[model samples]
Target chain A: MSAVEKASRPRVAIVNFGMGNLFSVRQACLRAGLEPSITSKKAELLEADGVILPGVGAFGRAMETLREQGLVSVLKDLAAAGRPFMGICLGLQLLFDESIEFGRHEGMAIFAGQVVRLEPGIGPAGRPLKIPEIGWKPLRPPSGRGWDGSLLEGLPEGAHMYFVHSFHALAAKSESVLAITPFGDMNYCAAVQQGRLFACQFHPERSGPVGLKVYENFRKMILSGR
Target chain B: MAAVRFIARLDVKGPNLVKGVHLEGLRVLGKPEDFARHYYENGIDELIFMDVVASLYGRNSLLDIIRKTSSEIFIPLSVGGGLRSIEDIRAVLAAGADKVCLNTAAIANPELVREASRCFGSSTIVVSIEAIRQPDGSYEAYTDNGRQKTGVEAVGWARRAAELGAGEIMITSVDREGTGQGYDLALTKSVASAVDIPVIACGGAGRKEHVGDAVTQGWANAVGVASLLHYNVLDVVGGTGSYEEEGNIEYLKGRRGFSHVERSSLGEIKEYLRGLGLECR
Candidate 1:
């Protein structure tokens, strides 16, 4: 296949470490018009055009699986090398320095931040709201830096996506933050971009057409260059 | 600031989407996947698939239905009914289901909620309750298709389930199910207030305003509808009339409540809710 055509059908390695529903992620990848191979194998990650670190459940257990499956170094290398990467929910949490959930679990430290619990009970409306913040929430309007022009390229300024998480990422540096979403007491970093590396505390696959649009834009980014 | 989720609940029996009033009467609709597509295209926020008769023999059909729906429908899907063990929950997730709603199993062993939540994250474990009202103005949680009472009061049990790590509590009012008398607002509000997790209010929605009431008055994070959507299937007289896929054509042939149902379109409902100042996509 020609380089352009080959780039158009980029293969993404969905990192699976005994956490998350890999099938749904794989399905989302396919919906984004990309080939997805759910694998824990090191060689698969090396061959793909991009990598997706999808995760759920406890941070400690997930870190254990990642270490045991021999993926920690590979992920760290990708982060340092600035490869196209995306993390969802717990995957996004795992990208930070540490998390307070189930004790202090050290993350990949790919970005500088700590994951902390959201303020529970009262929401912005002053009415009592549930934690774990389920359902669809709108992303705060992007900063002046905005998106990198591919991943969020045609997406509305304040597009909403499905989110289901108690803990959120807190960027140590404001410059690393790409998007902020409000939750009751305050607004936190909902999405961050470190060069080609992008991570979000929301599930793009579950966010309906807008979510699918996110994947489509990411797919275009992967196809734009060598 | 999350938009309230508008869910379409489809109950399956064997290979067909079945509808009943107050969780009874047994009316066949169409194929679950086809119905799911209709709602997905119409801008539904989420979907819930409950296998009305979830025995070991009937699981294959449900899995097939889910696998098909997940491929085309790119929204969050919560599947329930006959999920008993951690393996069963895993199997549902393996079939591309985003979340699993546990009613009978979670009730039998409350630890199952803890275990499943631990394995598949609390967000993926939704504790579903079929609440039947009592004479003394209390609601009892029922299992086995609401045939047997678990004696657990709706709000209290919902709190306990959330404490045990259940991510969401889906309370369906058996008393108001298919009754079109508007949601059991009192029951929904109580459970919603009791849990620290999201509460999904199901049943008793014959009007568009009832859905709005569930969010405003009932404090539900999401609203689940069945007869209002399934009974009022879109394009029954015009499109999706070919291939005779599964038993949908036959069911549609004998379809009831095509135009008689008092349900509004998904767009209309979202527009109405947004007009009411509720955030909706």
Candidate 2:
């Protein structure tokens, strides 16, 4: 823990658009052996060895805050430049073309998809499934795709993840959909991987030991410089 | 259907984690973080830390505990008790609490539920409803950890809180709490059926069968267990590591166990629930 050693560690910039708490994300990064900084400055974001977009809240409000902070294009360029990017929860929604939450709002458009609210459906017991889908769910790889060599590498097939959101993304292209999770009667995109950009609709930082592997993987990806 | 969340509830008084029958006459168990880490490692779905004496002191003292656990534990951490204002909520969230449970403040000013939800997303706001069943079979809302009674109806308050944008509701039965008998199924069902948001049933889980009843009969989306899990850990941990200058330490020093409530670990509870064909992580 010398200052020199601390500076030598990989820098992970967590985009702070002033929407939600970033403490858990920052703590997860440190536990994963990465030096994390919560910054919105374009230069700080671009200079980091890895970047994480962690958020919670309404999609339209988050986008508005990002735009107001002048971080819209900055995020797009970072994902476009392939800077080991990862998004969690609402951050995953902001990577799409647009979201219909609280009216249609533009997104960072790094991926081709539209975020829509989860359809209300009834559970097996005849009770209506709760909105926001607040609970732990296991991840299933999409057909023709695997977790191997991806952001979810080394994770088990049915690894449970913590999710808390009312809306999910609809990937236009099938190849972009990395994982799909089943609700009452619908299946929605849980995670997406296109080139260097990666995003998941679950909070890995809040998902426990199994979820911590995700941050560990991101740290390894940064150190490997791939 | 998604898996049912099995959460461990820890009632903290000063620096010690304590448990009491009817949320009174608390007996110090041990350190809060130790039990939290143990539960997290054992695959507990979530952890809730309630400051049992925060209302009496007029401030939440769980900030340090929350910060310490947020670094070591990698799961959702929710802190409650004496969160009166927006700044208090912000302070706890910034200290690494994923959600804040509001009871006294929300009951005093119902608008806090709406305002806090709007300010910090609905998902971050959880309305804690403590209820005591009346002679007429209607449940009344109680504040200050079931010490003060409000004339408001329990089920009606739940509907109102959800309408005010609360993403989740945690209904704790003051009568059933710490009794180790079972959850007040009537109280939970009425509230759960009233709101579309998730409702977590708290208190009165003596055995794994009680947990099953809470989900199957009570219709609880999640269960907040304290005595069953806490006593189980205490049996293994045996004696408090350090005597903190707060709360009652005599219970821990004597190593006297609670014979009334059956003890079970988080793993055993999840296994029993899964055996009954209920999905659990």
Candidate 3:
């Protein structure tokens, strides 16, 4: 990028946890008109204006990679300082207290919740809602007076976002829940907005135009009042 | 509040978009990115990219295209065609694919479905069944562009595939492919009702209503289209229609129930269905 472009762009570090595809996250950042860098370096992360934890695959492996890369303590520090951290999919699950996937795995504990398997049941139509509920589902925006969309500020009320997860988070406090998505007859927490930390259980980078708006909102949220 | 998905399926050869009759008589359309951009701008719910020649040529050919498209197009991208091993799946996913569709490999090694699902999570693996109708009215799954036949029945195998941890089933009717007569409602309904997971019905979609038929009558969670969606886009020089053509934009808008100019639009399928009360992206 040219000096002018680089100088003007907002640098967002896509944390290299080594589990998911960080390319798409960088792409989304670029689409949202921001400068993105995928790195595990503490200095680079600390220097950047923001951090995004893009994840896929298993949660235990992701946390292990984070620990191996020495990203756990750095991320904990960044998150503790409210450094505008965001997570996606398994990254979202990793923000919780713990999980019981292949085995019991402890998480970053930024959010009070436990990741658990989606209960077996039928959807509204009576057809069985299969596990790993793949494809797009609408987001049920938060209703409380102060629990607004926040990072999800610009998305439509019921905007459909792509999701691919078998385990869902059950937040300890309801106010932390930013949005919910239908998994069968019941709904699961789709996103959480705790302090400066914002994360979703879907691939916003892969959810088309509205999904782009999410990154745009995140950039705006991070850049404002800074 | 998740609505039904209307997807655009593009079969690629090298860097170019290509489509065949009955999945044969392959004809080059244009750059995969052009059509992908057009579809995305027109509000396509998702995209499926199949490297039609990966088995004949090499899987490497699609990596560049997928990398470029995944970087530009911000939507769910499902890549298929010659994916076999876990390494191949890893390479494709690394190249920016959200899900990898498996056909021949999954059939050749049923354990692959279990292993991939177990490793990457079931949501990332899509098992495609190209079904051919038998004289006895039962449907059988075929692989390798329908050149090879798997004796397993479509409905029963879909259930087995799901049980083996296949998260989603993309059932394409080989008999109806490229025909555009309409989706094989019976075949689609059978496989869709059989598996609890989301089903992507491909093949035989000529009219906009065919998409509707797939959801209402066939119970498919989503409809995948190629012929009816891409046939008219590329002009004589194998390029996407000249940008001067405002018809597709108008048609796309009109389908969203907007009042405006009238003309031939590529996404009429979604437009028509959107008017019929099916929530479309």
Interface RMSD, Å, model 3? 2.2
Stretches of candidate 2 off by over 4 Å are A1-8, B55-60
Best by lDDT: 2
lDDT (Cα, tens digit) per residue for candidate 2, span A112-208: 8899988767785666688767999989998789988788999999899999999999999989998988898778899998877889999999998
Error of 2 at A23 (Å): 0.1
Candidate 3 ranges with C-alpha deviation above 4 Å: A1-7, A146-149, B55-60, B235-268, B271-277
Task: Write the number of the candidate with greater lDDT, choosing between 1 and 3.
Answer: 1
Winner of 1 and 2 under TM-score: 2
lDDT of 3 by residue, A1-226 (tens): 7887775577999988666667788888998988888888999999988889888788888888888888888988998898888888888999899999889999999899899998657554444565666678888765662334488876667788888777889999888899987665567899998788899998888888888888888877777738
Q: How displaced is residue A200 in candidate 3, in Å?
A: 1.2
Residue by residue across B1-281, what tens digits does model 3's lDDT show?
A: 34677778988876667776667766666678888877877777789999887742354378877887788788888899999899999998888887889998998999999999887778888999999999999999998788788898988989889999888899999888887678999998898788767888998887777888888788788889876767555442235443332112333223232111122354565577678776665
lDDT string for model 2 (B1-281, tens) is: 57889889999888778889999989888889888888888889999999888842323358888888888998888999889999999988988899999999999999999999999999999999999999999999999878898899999999999999999999999998999999999899899889989999998999889999888888888999999888888866535477667777787777776876788877788889888888899
Question: How does chain B score by TM in each prediction?
Answer: 0.92, 0.96, 0.87
lDDT of 1 at A68: 94
Error of 3 at A202 (Å): 1.9
Please tell me the TM-score of chain B in candidate 1 relative to the true structure's chain B: 0.92
Q: What are the per-model numbers of colliding residue pairs?
A: 2, 0, 1
